[model samples]
Target: MAILIPFGLKMQAQNNTSGNKILVVYFSHTKNTKEIATQIQQLTGADLFELVPSRDYTTDYQALIEQAKKEINADYKPPLKNNLQGIDQYDVIFVGSPNWWNTFAPPVATFLTSHDFSGKTIVPFITHEGSRMGRSEADMKKLCPKATFLKGLPIRGSSVKEAKPLVERWLREIGVMK
Candidate 1:
């Protein structure tokens, strides 16, 4: 039984403008994070992009865990597809990913490193079983030292549908949507 909730006043309060160029980028293995990204796109008319690894992870849960662990332990930066051409056009970037070992997915890390975010604002949205943003906010600052990293929103992977309002509220606070 999936649940869906609309963005309420808290979200609307954050909407100070009617037009903003927002970009929502994420990488999902189980579709949980992607679903959240979709909702954000729908409300804000933000452009969306899914990070795809050069090689896909195995479908077996245990095998995927092992692979993720190895990458996290080694601080690996997996190769990513050539990013969206001219992604720099956006005013703000909303980065999303599933938490793996208390950090952003390796592919997302790869994408972060590949781009230059000199003066852009970055808002992180993470989905996890338990661990939330983990070290991702700090990691993003490290990766894009020139960009402004804002407060992040962390949601449970099991409660994504209930997250629409919260997600909208966040975008409003960050001045990404109206």
Candidate 2:
């Protein structure tokens, strides 16, 4: 079962072997992305923060797609309902988002741009139908030029509920778990 860890809550991880403070920030329109975020926390003991827009996106799939497409075409970054503080304290950030319009959701753009990730590391995790990472990784690099990125994880949205093992393996492969 996916843990319903509240967004923005800081939970001390049990196995922070790297000794670097870590945070998981994500934008989940559906719960698929959130489920992956929860798994990352369970594996690495990272804190969780949800990215919420000041205005929620429409629930209708077609409407949301059109909305996302327009936002991406314009390179828009919507205002977030909440933003993290003391961002400089975290050494690594696991950024999660649904692959929307071939990119990370707009709120993710705001979150990445709003912080100074210079000298920091970003571990990207994306959920998608079939687009996979699409242009999201490329766009993320543009958003945070100074941040170092590990290889990203792209899970099929339908497979998320069965993904704990995959998630654990990914953490080990990335050297986040050793």
lDDT of each: 0.79, 0.87
Tens digit per residue, CA lDDT, model 1, 60-153: 9899989999998897988765466676777678889999888899998888888889988888989998888898899888998999887898
- Each candidate structure's TM-score, on Cα atoms with residue i matched to residue i, is 0.85, 0.92
Which tens-of-lDDT digit does each residue in 24-136 have in candidate 2?
99999998999999889877878788898999899998999999999988989999878688888889999999999788999999998899999999999999999999988
Off by over 4 Å in 1: 1-19
Global lDDT of model 2: 0.87
- For candidate 2, the per-residue lDDT at 155 reads 96
Q: Indicate the worst ten consecutive residues by lDDT in candidate 2.
A: 1-10
Candidate 1, residue 87: the lDDT equals: 64
- Cα RMSD for candidates in order: 5.8, 3.2
Q: How many residue pairs clash (N, CA or C atoms closer than 3 angstroms) in each of the candidate models, in the order given?
A: 0, 0
Predicted structure with the largest TM-score when compared to the true one: 2
Candidate 2: list runs displaced more than 4 Å.
Answer: 1-13
The count of residue-pair clashes in candidate 2 stands at: 0
